[model samples]
Target: MAKLELIRNFCIIAHIDHGKSTLADRLLELTGTVAKRDLQEQLLDGMDLERERGITIKSHPVRMEYAAGDGNTYELNLIDTPGHVDFAYEVSRSLGACEGALLLIDATQGVQAQTVANVNLAFKQNLKVIPVINKIDLPAANLELCYEQMEEVLALPREEALCVSGKTGEGVKELLEAVVSRIPHPELLDIPGTAALIFDSNYDTYRGVVNYVRVKNGTFRRGTRIRLFNNGIESEVKEVGFFSPEMRAADELTAGSVGYLLPNLKSPSDTKMGDTITDVKDPCPEPLPGFKEVRPMVFSGIYPIDTADYEQLKASMGKLQLNDAAFLYQAETSAALGFGFRCGFLGLLHMEIIQERLRREYNCDIIATYPSVIYNVYMKSGEMIPVDNPVFLPDPSGIERIEEPIINCHIMIPSEYIGDVMNLVMSKRGICTNTVSVDARHVIITAEIPMHEILIDFHDKLKSMTRGYGSMDYEPAGYRADKLVKLDILVNGEPVDAFSSIVHTDMAYGRGRQLAERLKDVIPPQMFQIAIQAAVGGKVIARESIRAMRKDVLAKCYGGDITRKRKLLEKQKEGKKRMKQIGQVNIPQEAFVAVLKATETNS
Candidate 1:
């Protein structure tokens, strides 16, 4: 085990695409953690979805040994965190395991919205903040502007900022030296019992639950009887190891060190993230302060494409829950979609990523319903209920009021696009509360927007209006009473629960019309005409009809009597009427996919 005094625990925090993963690659290279031939870009981002999208979805931890200029070998425990707002919970959990944070700022794009948001989170954790300006090798690098913004916007000292290029490894050695000298060592607790805080975890088919922990007070070794403080589940330690970017077995993990623990966990849910692990025989007097529970803001239903895969989908979701703490799900059944889970997420992107992972990692074919936000429904009988799915909404006559979630959104963009962005916000029923000029060219607009309104296309629209120069960060701003109504979609006069949503009263007509039109284009035509309608409180607000496919019955009677032709046509009509009475509209899988895409873009 390494000495406690010679260890430094820190993490890299920044905006998305600000070079957090690239910088991690350089650090791993300089420290010689991975061999040169095996090194690749984004060595920490092991997921295929992360690599394909060039974004970090999870926080990765690795231990590195660096021989410093001070003539001593120092052990650096670095946690690389995701930068997107949806993954802020991941960053917060990572910060709980570290003593300092390197606030990375791109020299070309200085002081974006997420940059400020991350800095605030670091400050809240009482972590040592080291400002590092990255991507200095780019042609568009503007060091002067970056320094000014760091001083003015972030309120960070300009003299302490270090400049480096993660791509070319310029000034990386100095940066490492600074990390060792500037960041303080983890405070060693004098408590007796063994305790370690689980910052993250994942599931393995063979090994079961693998927990990534930071040892707090005592040493943990193999074959020790450990118990989780939160769940009171006991298991014998099967293995103890360090992540050299990959798990390497170690004899034991000592105090002030970060490593992994493999315990005999029965199920993934038994090992909760942020739970304290302690020796069962000599338990710690009190558990450490764990992270706050993460509440998912957006909710949707995930159903298996084939009903036989329901059990497999449940197993896959349990494993996924072990990996992602922000995702929540509970079993629910829908008339149209059959058995499924109503999953909750932090945002739209989080929901999308989870679905993709379910499809790719677990090989589960799933279909997701339209996303919705949690709403407060007050009944006339003086009872209140929180509704995330339209199917659970109570009858309109019995409901007294409905309150929708609101968010405080901060958007940073170029000054020239302020007018366009403000207009867009107003169109979405959002009000711009304040605007501040960060520098001569950039402006930060603060607005209060309903959570459901901005769930799908708000970010995309902001980027387009600003020409890809805008960034946004948001937080929940409580809920407010609103004129909300549940909108239902019907196919051939049958309500489809998967397509139902709770929408504001003013936008109900237009949204319903758009959905009806999109569904009309996707649902295949049958022998009889199919009517698609959008209804609010049993009143049809919008309607569309798919014409039936006609058969050429007259081809055999070229010049026959007109009465015979009329009889043939009348017979065909009667057949169609009978089919319509007994026919069931087979809504294809593609129809759901097409309608989902339409709803996202139209919102």
Candidate 2:
């Protein structure tokens, strides 16, 4: 086994588009872990979508060999994590595997919202946070302003922080040295039983489920019998390997090391991130501390456009779930859209990513309804229901008082656009908790708002208001009392369960009118007129109509007696009854998706 003192475990944390992946590529090149000829942009980002979007969706861990100035060669395991708020849980899981973290801030952007949020998490975990400012090669880079932001906002030592450029090989050598000298090696225990933290896991057709773990005590070797501490599921370790940037078979992963293990796991549900893995014969006495389960914060209904694709969609979702254990979904049916799945996601971005993958990866055509947040419904019948799907909203009479999930949102923007940003947030039921200046031109605002409001294009609007100079981060802050009402949509007098949503009473009328108008545009004209209405319970709040196809039936008649007029009127009434009974409104697939865009009140 390698000497524990020669090992350094850490992860790189930064905001989205802050060059974290580029820095990882540079580090790999400098360390010679991967040949220089093989290096490419975002080498660690394995997902095709990640590369296309220029973002890291999943956390990638790699082991590197570095020769420090002290003339001693050290081994470093660096976990590259996604920087978006939607993947914060991935960040947390990655941090739990390491003893230190590289807290990177963009020199041009300084310390934005997520920058401070990452530092606070490092502080919470007691990780050795090595502060660094990147993109110093850019002409607009404000190195001095970055120092001040780190000092004032992050409360970091400005003089000690390193400045580096991922674009050009500058200051990276010193940063590597700092990591080895400053970051402590993992203090692993030598006990009779084995223990490891499964920070992340994914599935393979041949290998079943492959888990990436950090061994805290003992060793994990091929042929060793392992069990998950929480679930008590047991399997024989088929393989033990470390990332040589690619999975290379390692004889064993000793204590204080991170690697992957194939243990003949049957299914993804059999394993979980943050669960303790131990030897089956000699299980540990206790699991690790502070293992919070992944809870989905945003939910939406994903219905297949064609009813026959329901089974294929279900199989696709199951395969996707084997890779992502955090994504929750259940089979559901809608009268308007037919068979579908009600999926729960960590955030709006997470929801969108899942929806995109369903269409792109599985080739399944789907209609995703408006995203919703979980709600707690208390009823007079002494039943409390958790409503994640909009179709299952409890009746208004039974609800004692509706409670909505709230969140504490942090927004950082340029001082010049502070008024615009504040106005935008306040209009979305935001209560400003605090506002402070980060630097001469930057300001940070803290607000408490309904989480549901944020799911509906809040980030998009925030960027539009701040001219793309703003960044945001937020977390769920318990539930609170709210005046929420369920708004239902009816097409041709037939209620569409897919379009129902529980919205704030004050904004329901506006949202209803918008939905009606949008649907009127999308629902094609039929032989007979189709009336679309949005109602709150039994009262109609808004209405729109798709006019019937007109024909010149009266062109043939120049004049008529009362008998002829009466006969024509009777014939028109009979046709109206038949149309009402049999006519079907050809609702465009775009109509369901249009409702989500219509509900955005961020402006």
Candidate 3:
């Protein structure tokens, strides 16, 4: 093991498709941590879905050995982070584990919304930032332009920016040397107690939960009592190791080293991200800076397509929750869809990933309800409660106010498309606060918009309007009072709680009308005309009717007497009345998720 003074810990940060993973693969190869043949593209992205989507959904940490020009071998730990703003929290955790960051920019695309946001975050963390322009081998690569944007937008050095090709390995050797020289070694803390930051973890069915940590103060070894300072949970260490892209047993990890610790954690929740790890005998006087608690901003109900799959879905979710503490769910019953779990997520991507994992990993078929954001309701009795699912929302009379979440959204796009993009955002109730021109071609637009407004198709719209040249990053701007109402869908006068949603008062009429019409298209006609009504507090805003199956009662009575025709008509009326009374509308599973399907199509 390298001495503390020779250790360098850092991470790669960039915007989506900015070549973060490819650059990481290059770094791994430079260090010879993994042989050339062993590397597949984006090797750090472990999940198949990640490869399929061409994105990094998780942060991966690895340790490497590099021999710098200074004539000393250094222990280099690289924590690779996700690029999308939806995974911003994950990026923060990864950043917290490092002392420096490699800010990679696309030589062609230049700085973007996430690029600016992540660089600012790194600055906030006080990590040494190294700007490296990537993809210089591309035909459209413009190194000087990227440098100008980096300097203007990120306040980074123009000349100090290094140009490299992550694909062709151009200038990579110099980049590694630069990392060793420029990125300072981790500060050696000689405090009496031991301390480590638990930035990430993964669960294994066989060996249990393994926590990835950056040793901040003292040594950690196997067969010793250890404690998680946040929850004061302690257990004897079962194993201690390091990841050179793969687990390798280590005798001990001291201050300034990155490694993994296993305490036989059977449940992943036990090893919470951002928790502090310390030696049980001489614990730290205080825990390291506690990470911000991430709450699920978007929520929806998930039901099994097959009723028998409920237990399977529940089991899958339980195991998934063990692996992902951010995913939250509780038992919920819908009058229209039967029993299911109401789940909460950080955003749309997180929600989509979890749903896809359930389908692909667990082989479960499920229907998800319309996603909604949490709302704060003040009741008539001076009580305040958070309602994530519409079913829990109290009557309008009983509630004094409803507060909805809002966000400060940052958008980066080419200057030519700003008009259309701005108009689209403004239509979603966005209020622009600031705009800046990094150069003549690119601009950054900052706007405040409702969090839920961007829940469905905001990104897709931005990309479409900008001709796929726009990107967005956002942070919560807190909540404010809004004119909100719960729009309920009723089929033949019977309300379907599963189709209920909270919407802005101004959009209630049009959205309700759209939903009712769409429902009409999907619903099969009953023996009697089916009335689909969209209502708010018992007041109907829009309505649609599905024509019933009609029969020519007199067709078979061509030669029959008028008395016979009258008798048949009476019998038909009785049958219609009986069907309308005893027969329930059989809503197809597709009908339950029609809004989701529509949103997907739009996206």
lDDT of each residue in 375-489, candidate 1, tens digit only: 9999999999999999889999999999999999999998999999999889889999999999888899999999888988989999988999999999889999999999999
Per-residue lDDT of candidate 2, residues 1-603 (tens digit): 568899999999999889999999999999999897888899999877999998888999999989899999998999999899988878888999999999889898888899888888888889999998999999999899988888889888887799899889799999999999999998866455779999999899877888999999888889999888777888899999999789888999998898999988778888888888999777788888657789899888888877889999999999999988889999887777777888999998788788889899999988787788889998888888999876788778888888899999999999999888888888899898999988898889999999988887789888987788889999889999889999999998888887788899999999888888888887778878899999998999999988888665555666867677667767876897798799777676677766655554431
Better of 2 and 3 by TM-score: 3
Please tell me which model should have the higher lDDT, number 2 or number 3: 3
The count of backbone overlaps in candidate 1 is 0
Candidate number with greatest lDDT = 1
Candidate 1 wrong stretches, greater than 4 Å: 190-193, 306-312, 549-583
- Is 1 or 2 the stronger prediction by lDDT? 1
TM per candidate comes to: 0.93, 0.96, 0.97
* Candidates in order: C-alpha RMSD to true structure: 2.6, 2.0, 1.7
Candidate 3, 430-509: lDDT as tens digits:
89989989798998999999988898889988898888879999999999898999999999889989878889899889
Model 1, global lDDT: 0.91
Better of 1 and 3 by TM-score: 3
Lowest-scoring 10 consecutive residues by lDDT in candidate 3? 594-603
